[model samples]
Structure formats: structure tokens, C-alpha cells
Target: MSADIKAWYLSKTVWGGVLAIIASIANIAGFGISGAEQAELADGITALLAAAGGIVAVAGRLVAHRKLK
Candidate 1:
């Protein structure tokens, strides 16, 4: 596969998936604070992180290809 494709996959697929899993575990385990509120907050945070990671990864790959060309 091309470097750009590889980079994109790593960012959007691997990192994003990893973050989601971690977040889910943290929420279930009650890593911080207390009550259902804390769990809901954690879920929100996790979703944001996953989204950001995906965006960054895809953008980075695109930039890399553009620069290399």
C-alpha cells in the first residue's frame, strides 16, 4: 500500500478504534468522579477523542501525500 493510505488507515482505523475501546473500559470502570453522570461524561469525552483522532489522521495523510508529490 502507499504511504498515504497506510498513514490514513493507522490514524482513522487503528488509533480511533483503540481510543474508543479504552474510553469504553474507563467509563465502565468509573475511572474518575462518581455516579452515572461521570460515566456519561466519560462517554462524551471518548467520542470526541475518537472523532478528533480520525480527523487528524486523515488530514495528516492527505498533507503527507501533498507534500511528497
Candidate 2:
């Protein structure tokens, strides 16, 4: 694949993974529940943030790529 594609893939994968881990850790630490409730809320918030981050990242990448093109 081209460098641009590779870079995009890397950015999305790496940053997405990082954000997910962070959110998970934050939820685990932020709310000290150890059962279903904890998992539910933490996973919910983390998924939400991860989705938002992915959207922003993709949009930014598209804009930057457009500019480069």
C-alpha cells in the first residue's frame, strides 16, 4: 500500500487502541464498582469516547489528506 494509506491505517489503529485503553483504565479507576454495574457504565462511556475519537480522527485525516492531494 501507499504511504498515505499506511499512515492513515497506523494513525487510526494506534490512536484508537490508546484511547480505548485509557478510557478503560479511567472508568476502572474513576468508579470503584466491581460487578455488572461497573462493567456496564465503564464500557458504555469508554465506547462512547472511542467512537467520538474515531470520528474526529477520520475527519481530520480526510481533511489533511485532501489538502495534501
Residues 1-69 of candidate 2: C-alpha lDDT, one tens digit per residue: 574564333454454555566667877888443345544555665666668878998889888845653
Cα error of candidate 1 at position 32, Å: 14
Question: What is each predicted model's overall lDDT from 0 to 1?
Answer: 0.61, 0.60
Candidate 2 residue-wise lDDT at 30: 89
- Please give the lDDT score for candidate 1: 0.61
Cα displacement (Å) at residue 53, model 2: 1.1
1-69 in candidate 1: lDDT tens per residue? 575554333344454455667767887898643345545555666677768888988889988846653
Name the lDDT of candidate 2: 0.60
Error of 1 at 10 (Å): 15
Q: Which candidate number would show the highest TM-score if scored against the true structure?
A: 1
